[model samples]
Target: MQLKGKRVLITGGTRGIGRCMIQELIDQGVSHIGIIARDKKSLKELSEGYPEVKFIRIAGDVANIDILREAAARIEDKWGYLDVLINNAGIVSAGPTEELLDEDIYDQVAVNYTAILLLTKYCIPLLKNAEESAILNISSGLGLIGMPFYSVYGSTKAAVRQFSDSMRRELAPFNISVTCSFPTATDTDMMQKFEGVEMDTPEYVAKKSIEGLVNKELHVIFGGEQRIKDVEMNFSDPKKFDAQVAKTYDQFKQSSEGHKAM
Candidate 1:
């Protein structure tokens, strides 16, 4: 649907791809946005940067159920309807699963999966109240193809992909749509730990992802043709895909060393 004058609620909209998506929403004429993030100061700066827009800043960690509840309540109390809900907040803790810290694993699941479920659950009514509504979930390329060291991160994203599909079908009768985007090694704060990896710009990813939502596209898969082929290979030829992954197992392990962006 067209974004002009639409009201949106997004998580972690103050930094990384989420930040760029906020800018994209503004460019598409969205005037009212509700943002949930941990940094109150960053939320204030975001509002100042975009004086023409109305921002409902809920500064708290999305992993907190209370914060998710607060966001939906505030939106209903103010706007009464929502045109878009962007589940853009995510965290990654990489490395071999057995070697990973317990807290990091729990945090990844909480921030990357539980938040989406809780926030989306809370916003369903507001979405149905609108003339048309859409949900944009940001998954990862790793979610499409399992990798060695990114088990937790990939699982959370894969859950997002599955949730998007389920929600799309469930909300079809209500004139609501869901779009899931799979971005690979995006150049964002989440990728800061990687030493050397060619990545997609957060700006480009944000633009395409938003376009997918507006156009009602089912899936916005990044990483070009190779990523598509990899996904196909993993699904069609598990043994072959395993062999290919085995060849680069060491590389993934090395790159993911101490990777934490929570």
Candidate 2:
């Protein structure tokens, strides 16, 4: 779908990939862009920088269905229709599943999966009003393959992948495209939480996201060969994929410790 003059809403737009996407949308001639984030200071800064772009900042937890519905109401009030809904808000908690707490699992599922679902549910009506509309869900490569120390996080992303697929088929008749983006570790503050891990920059993801949106691509797998290999391995053998991931996790753990020491 053409982004020019499109009314776009992006969750978690205060920083990282979401922030990059907002700038990219502006570059693509999007005149109205609404950003939902919890940081008022960052929202104020963004509003100051891009005064021409319609920047609406809603500060609240995306996990709260009521909050999301309220945000949707506000969007409906400001703009009668939404051309794009970018479900970019997500969170990660890494640790062995056996050692992971209930809160960790709950937080990841709530933020990564539940929030996206709820937001999409509320935005569908607004999207239906537009001539062309799309929903872009930000998943992860780990979603396709279970990774050690990231069981909860991976599970949530996997759920998003499946949800996107089903929603795409359901929304096809309405011409509202559904796209799922799977980017490998990205160079954001989230990546800093994991030491010594080579990650793609948010700029890379932002560019790919724009490309995918323009092309109306159903699925996007970023991070090049490694990401492709992960998909291949998972399709080849689930058990083998898990075993390989376990081995890689050991190496990553060791590297993380070394980096912490230095």
Best by TM-score: 1
Q: Estimate the Cα RMSD of every predicted model relative to the unseen true structure.
A: 0.7, 2.8
Error of 1 at 98 (Å): 1.0
lDDT of 2: 0.84
For residue 234, give model 1's deviation from the true position in Å.
0.4
Q: Tell me the whole-model lDDT of each prediction, alpha carbons only.
A: 0.94, 0.84
lDDT tens digits, residue span 1-262, model 1: 8899999999999999999999999999999999999999999999999989999999999999999999999999999999999999999888888999999999999999999999999999999999999999999998888888889899999999999999999999999999999998888888898867898899999999999999999999998898889899899999999999899888878888978888
**Per-candidate TM vs. native?**
0.99, 0.94
Which segments of model 1 are wrong by more than 4 Å?
none
Query: Clashing residue pairs in candidate 1, if any?
Result: none
TM-score, cand. 1 vs. native: 0.99
- For lDDT, the strongest prediction is 1
